[model samples]
Target: MKNLFPILLMLIIMVNASAHGGKNHEHANIFENLQGNNKAAILMVHFGTTHDDTRALTIDALNKKAQAEFPGVELREAYTARIVIKRLGERGIIKQKPQDVLAQLKKEGYTHILIQPSIIIDGVEMESLQKDVVEVQSQFKEIRIGDPLLYSPEDYEKLIDVLTKNIDSETAYIWVGHGTYDSNTAQYAMLDYMLKARGHTNCFVGTIEGYPSFDDMHQQLKASRLKKVVLVPLMFVAGEHAKNDIAEDWKNDLEKEGYSVEVKMEGLGQNPEVQDLYISHLKFKSAHRKIGIIEKKAIYEVTGEKME
Candidate 1:
């Protein structure tokens, strides 16, 4: 019996070491090893908000997740609208600017860049992001471009899974998307359809600028007698709209209308699953480099390509 105890202890130690080694291996592979100045850079392109604090919070969440998952890769964050607004307001005209951003990246020795957009739905912002990508690609000789995040149908299904964690069919789930004036409105329809397809009947997707606005969902919620609603931003960060417009402003209006309402402000940005989705997308593109470019272009044509 005493002899048996030592052998059991040795076996347990081996098991623990093996498990720890596996985790370390995963971490090492995720970050990748780029010696000297050849490391891959991740550019998280957000539809910049005028509110600095909100934008910081949103970008920080994504960066933190990326840093955690990929311990070594360099990460950069930029806002398209806010950057353009500042440049135009200060300079009196929009400067053709990819050199400044790429210059810094080039100085740092980054050759491959994966641009991830925080855009919820397709729109003019995505088109602008694509332009930035093309401009950057032109600047760097060995640059590899990653598709904008919402460019994938899997993103919608991933969103459904992420939201499902916070809510159930009993509670009304309302996702507030930033709708575009352009034909990218189909992305929201995809969001709505995927949500319903996932068996979330009490769920509805509404946009701030497009159809099924807050008023539309509010009326439906009141009419249906659902007292509790979980409001999630279809955005990267639970910014002004999620924090103020929906939780405080809209809830106050709903209460005045004599409907008992409960609001849960859990933005998709904070969801780890969403972060994992982005990481997986990155890894897939990185692994299958040849087909990645072709597949990405096809997706862009379907999702971001404008209609006549």
Candidate 2:
């Protein structure tokens, strides 16, 4: 009976230890599943350019960012640039068509897809992408689409912050926007407010198509005594504007005008924070899923709020 008493006590201790360990394990499982069990698929849709280097760089940057943020999620790219995609295939930059890439992603165990468009503003490409997302959602009900980076005013703030990083007070930061004749110029107008808020005295934002012209730029350059200028394309890929127009053609005119202009073209998509725009979208889509929110609204949209 004495020996049996010690054995019974030891058994009770073992049972308690097992119970404690079991509770911890169960708690860990709950924490993991609280987020969700489904694997996320990310599709980075861009208005792709035929410019091989530019397209490659833009897609590569998007992929890199997605890999860094959602290491476990599946990632793919779809281009709206049909001509560019065809040219990329000829140049061997892209091996398969956009449809083929979509099929491959579907085959993977990706239950939820987050579509992120790289369009700068609500242009024709953006409107078309919204339609595509609607069609894709009808086919893949499981895929929940996130808002485009520029869809909301919050996104513009992020863009402003990103641009501010590459600019200094000594240099005038000029952005080249792709504008349309029909639409309201409200998008480009935001730049003036943002720059003013940043205390940038010499910053200007204008479009390639309509209102703001290079002639205007030449006039400003001549008038400015700052003497240092940085010209960056607001375009996703620094395609034709960056290579031919700004760096090459514009240089000849500016040089002849006797203003020492330093031209540097940085693709807005290449900026690291721009990737966070997508990350923010993913977090918004996957809030209930196990992942913790790293940054809450890193870019907040201001609608109906006056920008001083």
Estimate every model's Cα lDDT from 0 to 1: 0.62, 0.62
lDDT of 2 by residue, 58-152 (tens): 76777677768778766787878777777778877774434555567657645456666676777677667666655555544355445566656
lDDT of 1 by residue, 1-308 (tens): 87866755644443344344332111222225455646677666665545445544555676677667666767776656656558545746433334356668878877767656656656777677667666667655444434445666776776677677756556677777767656777778677777778777788888777766667667667665676666667777666677787788767876787655677665566666776676665565444332234443443354453211
TM-scores, all candidates, are 0.69, 0.70
The superposed Cα distance between candidate 2 and the true structure at residue 183, in angstroms, equals 1.5
Clashing pairs in 1: none
Q: Candidate 1 — worst ten consecutive residues by lDDT sum?
A: 22-31
- TM-score, model 1 to reference: 0.69
Once model 1 is optimally superposed onto the true structure by TM-score, how far is the C-alpha of residue 267 displaced, in angstroms?
A: 2.7
